[model samples]
Target: MTQHPTKTPQFFLTSPSVCPYLPDQQERKVFTHLVGDRAPELNDLLTQGGFRRSANIAYRPACETCRACVSVRILAEEFAPSKNQKRVLKRNSDLVGTLYPAEPSSEQYDLFRDYLLARHAHGGMAEMSVLDYAMMVEDSFVDTRVIEYRRRGPDSFLTGEGEGELVAVALTDEMSDGLSMVYSFYDPKQEDRSLGTYLILDHVRRAREAGKPHVYLGYWVKGSRKMAYKIRFQPQEHLMPAGWERYQPD
Candidate 1:
């Protein structure tokens, strides 16, 4: 009888660094490469285990003392848009989202650059060049798609595609259970449209239509003002040591 060897993923730990979301704190990460024919399956499993994918890597916070980062996922079937979310949807009603293969474009990079410069000038991604942006969008082994949000054109109803300038872009991964939002960016000039929140709401609708139960939203740091927006999506599940449980913040 031939025996098949069990393949185990190799993980590496990063050196301690200043936490980006929290002050007076340090952060470390345990990450492994997501490659090979099994990359998609591995990504889905790791994501369900509280790991997040970046490019071809899967990483999760492994801080020594702080456990502030919590994985969150929205219950797509049960998600009800609040009054404010409804308003956001109505505001962006003229926009349409079309999913495309994982390919990079100059227009997408331009918007990404502008968003970083305006909203995250001091963040690490501020230094990303066009090439870096391409890698972020296309250097993936899993089943990934780039959804471009644009103004609805005259023929949009016929083609189911958007036209005109790209207003927002979401890099997402299709998993067995749900859609995992890897990263997203939007035109800062359209702040009143609340494009960020609208993107999440759209994903929930997309997931529900695809028969998916959840929409992974990455980590929600408890004390980070920037991360506080994630909690606004109610009826979400927070991955806990016990298991994923309902989280309704007070």
Candidate 2:
């Protein structure tokens, strides 16, 4: 019998780039590749330690002077939708989200392009081609799923799938503890429906139903208006320097 030694992951630091979440600030990250037979286990452990997965890489902020990117996870078991969130749920009640294997489709790409054009026209992913989008959805070594949102069909209950055009899409990773929302986008024309909030609310419901304790929401960067939506889903825990601690916003 041959015994193999466990391999330690090698991490590398990214070059400083202008912070996407903060003005006049630079951001750096330390990342490791999440590959091989240990990918799932490694993803779970790294995610618990504040790293977020992109493709097959696990990364966390490693800025030199700023410590604003705080990892957040919703306590799904104890979460209750607020009045506004409840309204969002009600507004999106006609829609159904069906979980599918992490495979990219032309329909999904169309929706993705529309979302980027309308919401993040000048952002990093604005120029992403179909191939890049495919890699984003398909290049994974961990447990990943794609949830597509669409209008409820007359036979939806029988098929467990919605009908018509794809209104929204969510790329998620199922970890040992909870679901991690990697990236999500929706029809910018349906802004009034608040599909973004509905997605998170639905995931919370899912996590509770599945007996999961928390739903990882990546990072909540302070002072970033884009990230402000995250803190609304309380009672969540923030990964502070002292470790994961409950956060109660006043």
Candidates' lDDT values, in order?
A: 0.94, 0.93
Candidate 1, poorest ten consecutive residues by summed lDDT: 1-10
Instruction: Report the C-alpha lDDT of model 2 over 135-238, residue by residue, as the tens digit.
Output: 88888888899999999999999998999989999999998999999999999999899988999999999989999999999999888999999999989999
Clash number for each model:
0, 0
Name the lDDT value of residue 106 in candidate 1: 99
> Model 2 lDDT vs. the true structure?
0.93
Clashing pairs for predicted structure model 2, backbone only? none
User: What tens-digit string does per-residue lDDT give for candidate 1 at 48-117?
Assistant: 9999999888999999999999999999999999999999999999999999999999999999999999
Extract clashing residue pairs from model 1.
none
